[model samples]
Target chain A: MKGPAISIQDLHVSYYGNEAVKGVSLSVETGNLVGIIGPNGAGKSTFLKAMLNLIPKDKGDVKVMGRTIKEVRKRIAYVPQRNDIDWDFPITVLDAVLIGTYPHLKLFRRPKKKDKEWAMQCLQRVGMQDFSKRQIGELSGGQQQRVFLARALAQQADLFFLDEPFVGVDVSSEETIVKILKELCRQGKTVIVVHHDLSKANDYFNQLILLNKELIGFGTVEEVFKPEVIKKAYKGQFAFMNEIGVSL
Target chain B: MAFIEAVMQYGFLQKALLTSVMVGIICGVIGCFIILRGMALMGDAISHAVLPGVAISYMLGINFFFGAVFSGVLTAIAIGFVSQNSRIKHDTSIGIMFTAAFASGIIIITMLKSSTDLYHILFGNVLAVRSSDMWITLGISLIVIAAVYLFYKELLVTSFDETMAAAYGLPVRFIHYFLMTLLTMVTVASLQTVGIVLVVAMLITPAAAAYLLTERLWVMIFLAAGIGVVSSIVGLYFSFTYNLASGATIVMAATSIFVLVFLFSPKHGLVWKTLRVKKKRASLV
Candidate 1:
């Protein structure tokens, strides 16, 4: 971990007159795989949205790679937590993967051969190359998550914000995503994941940003994920966290 | 010999037949997108909303098609803008826009000093379909079909998961607005042949029947077109024999087909699934 890749200062997020994320601030280093662990309704998702400026913040500043988020939009990729899409829609998986290249492609210019090849490569990375021509509805939950990851891969950005990528996914898919994240960090790309499982924290991420609406702590897994901070962040919750201490 | 003589007798009947087949093809291709995207109600709303556009165009004494296109797309854009800005959902926005458009059409019709040409807007007197309207519908439908074929993949992704598509750098916002505009155009063009009330049946029923039959997109589109042509031809024959409105009869026929398919489709049909379950239980016993 070196200089900060993402800087957050006094961030606050509210929804429909209720504050979900109170004042929070943290800086994340470049190429660090960060895990956010908190109890349910602890504003984890809200904080993630605020980081990307996807949701309106009451008062805050988020700078990615020393520039404002809007200025560095192309360098950042976001995969939403809950996507309420119409599943039976008429499109092949290849079409869905191709969309990941939209931000880089010129407006009004159709996708060229190189763009198609990139889409295929991303799907291949996710091991979904065989399902490229399959209908989206035919895919299982884990397969769908892989496609989502493939979309992010297509972006080829420096920073990726993923909201709960492992939820409802199969073991193989989870391992595949973890491997991909590791590869991403190796390539000097930062990956921020909103993870629910505390047991897998140490195994998945080197840096831990513990929170419960407020920033409890942010450091390496060894430094920040102590018993004291874990209790404060997820007190009276996570029976599994008590049974197994950060090793699943 | 008698049937051949009847076919050769009147040019109007031949024109009407050709018009129905062309419109059938257009509806079949477009309606597949509508069904898959769950915009079946959007198509319905646009058909009803085109009424005022037609009535106002008729009063202006200009190309009615142009008037319909302008008004229909305007209503669509308005709906899109309002829904995006407001907290209201897409369905609610559609309902509000559809009612307002319909009311405006009624007011305009009542204000016109001339006698109510209600049939032109409501039932679409196929007997009165001019060569001019035919040319317009044909040209616009061809363009729309061609566009759909070209951007087949983009339309699918946006329809399935808009946010993911947007994040991936797809112009989801543009596609959303473009889809509504195209739908409005299709509705306006078909208004003369099918009327505001029956155009929905033309847009929805064929695709719905196709949905019951297949999960494949290409197959659904083909099936929808086949059903549309059958309904149009059979209904036209019935209308000619019984002195009924051709458009109304065609929609009724399509509705009947929908009911039949919905009841008896092998996989997802109501009757087959029920009976199959019962048979499985019986075998277990």
Candidate 2:
């Protein structure tokens, strides 16, 4: 609560003796729409998971809201990639969102009417109120992503981590998601996204953390979105674009 | 009607019938989760692993139920440990542990030359179920059903998305082990009636049919139970009248129902989907 909203120091993660996320350090302030852009297999998703303590970190110091991750885990929400979910699972959209409140409920107690109402409200926020009763498999890819966002919203978390939220999503759903994310930032919540598209990165995030297995730059869009930094992070593969003034 | 009357005249027949119904309901309930999680092979492994436990229990002159449950749980843990600690995949782990345990059981039986019939344990003799076995089946069924009812949501979430469950701070590991323990208990309770060879069918076929019929978890569960009970009753009647192997007859009954649902269920059945496709093509023409 005093320092940055999220602080990572000397974070290192490995899988099968191969380093996935090299030693990295960064700090993010509260209310920042931070985009973590990197090449494929550059540990963008691994870094987010490491920060949340979802995966084992070989060496790292991660603190959220000036507190250790364990102390504030309940205050954090994560929307994993769509590929990690079972699309054919037999659950309604409302039931899926209501799972977010499971941390607050007592054991052996079912979700009450008020909890259902709150879940409906979260669905409404994501423009999925009409589809709450439908099974998850019946929805299109974009609607499914929106439903996942609604689940995150139902958590009422102050810190949100989304991995590839726009992949395979329709344009309208992507816009709706961006609008809701900006809204969350306006409400003083920190939203960190693992983004891929470089063209819309400037318009989407106020702060950008360019990474390629290591921290390349962490600053505002104007400060960090430079030609030299983009070229270095993408290993000189970024083509020069006159519109964004950077070649990512 | 006369055949039913003649079958019901014996006390052993009455006990066996009750045991069949109880086994049917319990297996049906647990089978829904098994098939949903794609753990049908795991169910097969645990059931097979119980053979050694039964042999050992007979050697020690203890309750075979305890031995069978212990062996089943030990197999589950071994599978989990092997898969987690090594590069061996889950299916491979299951295959290794179950075959080894089953082999050990056979060896022990042969070495001891125990008079306890191994054939009965392997293929089951449902008509031979004693009153005590019926009581044990009843108690285990009650416990399994209650556990499923109490932790339905937690189990549902964990089975659906384990990561989300862990993120929500639910004791996912504990839930997993507890579910494994319940699976073992059910497997052990069912051993006397269905035997090792056919137990997996009892745990899978009815639930699979129900899965084809319904889209909701609770509905699938209830429908599975209904299918299991009906199959058990009909199979028992046929076994009584025709003097066939009761366990095999019951499994065949469940399989018949599954085939019917697979072909004819209005929502997800193969026939309907094919018909719908043909109709659309015809309309285009």
Candidate 3:
């Protein structure tokens, strides 16, 4: 709510000598739901990963909450693409959510009873408390996504980063996740999502980061959703966005 | 009863029993992570790759433990290096490197035709296990147990999702190498009981069977260790009584348990799934 919660200066990322994300500079204020949208190969995931320090960045200075990622890592919570992990792993839902408390606990220390109650509360927020004992593999895609949200909520961080969280999610689950993210924002948290659904970008987030290897626009949804900006970022590949009947 | 009597009658059989059970428990503990991380083949690779190390150690009149662990861990790191740095898939690298080390081991073993104990190193002869080997197995078992106990959270995160672990500032690569090191130590510790060749079965089968039967990792670990203990106990019985090859017998016992769980596990078994479908159909009709 004070300075920018996330600030990046000329960030760059590439894969194996090929440039994936180019010089992108932006500062996002806290307590807002922001969406990063682009085409399939627009490096949306790459940009988010680079910022989160999940992947190697060729060049950049990325800071969260006025500190380097390593210095303020405990305040950052990340939920990677659901499919990026093994769903069939033999882990119960509650146990998965308990992983969020790991960062707060000291090394070699187990999650205390209070942590369990807090995790349960996080699960309840996403309406997943009933399925706490269920194995994660048995859940529907939407339910799985909600559990991920619950885990993020349990992190109790000032910022959240989720990548393609709604890819296979059901409509109700999508609504639930957006509602929770908004609640986090209401609580003065910054939520950044790498979303591909151009249709729901306006509804789900207050700010939009249109990216395609470079920063095309970064501002309020109304201010940045211009036709030219969308076209420029999508490289004339805004056919689907047009079909959605946006003013852009 | 005869096997139990033999175990009571002979110190050698007692040592074999203790050593095999230790191998079983440690293998089961480590194998959960191995299989869960989808590195079951890495288990096999490290096991086989220890062959050359064992051969060199024997030739040099040293304990095979250090040499075997060195070769096994080195081969594991090399596989990761090749797969990571090049276009070669992990499995291909594993197949290439482990087999090369194993072949080198075979040649070295062949040249040392005077040593009758080397074949035991390959196929495992628990009866011939020495007191030093038992102590080493005990030590490795304690270390593996304590390590898993201490680092349960980190292991859970890394095994489930590496990116999330890295995001939390965990050293993902360090965890991988640490696991490979533990695996190499385990593979080496198991040499006298299951040996270099058949140790992978002990590592995989019990853990996999437990995975099918449980929904929690801690539960799976416990179940796996239990099954591993049972397999070794049963295996030693049959081997001691029938005069069969100990490693093969132990591996077969573990496999039989895995097959049973695959077909008849109460929760995730194929048979239960089919029966549930049939019951639903009958009710609908």
- Misplaced by over 4 Å in model 2 are A236-248
- Cα lDDT, model 1, residue A151: 82
Where does candidate 3 stray beyond 4 Å? Answer: A239-248
Tens-place lDDT per residue, model 2, B45-91, is 99999989999998999989899989988889999999988899999
TM-scores, in order shown?
A: 0.83, 0.95, 0.97
Worst window of 10 by summed lDDT in candidate 2 chain A: A239-248
**What's the true lDDT of residue B186 in model 2?**
82
Ranking by lDDT: 3, 2, 1
Show where candidate 1 strays beyond 4 Å: A1-13, A22-25, A47-83, A91-135, A154-158, A231-248, B1-8, B77-87, B113-116, B213-219, B222-226, B256-285
What tens-digit string does per-residue lDDT give for candidate 2 at A170-234? Answer: 99999999999999999999999999868789999999988888888889999888877887887
Across B154-206, the per-residue lDDT of candidate 1 in tens digits comes to 77556666655554446666886677677777776667667788887888899
List clashing residue pairs in candidate 1: A103-B169
The candidate maximizing lDDT is 3
Candidate 1 colliding pairs, count: 1
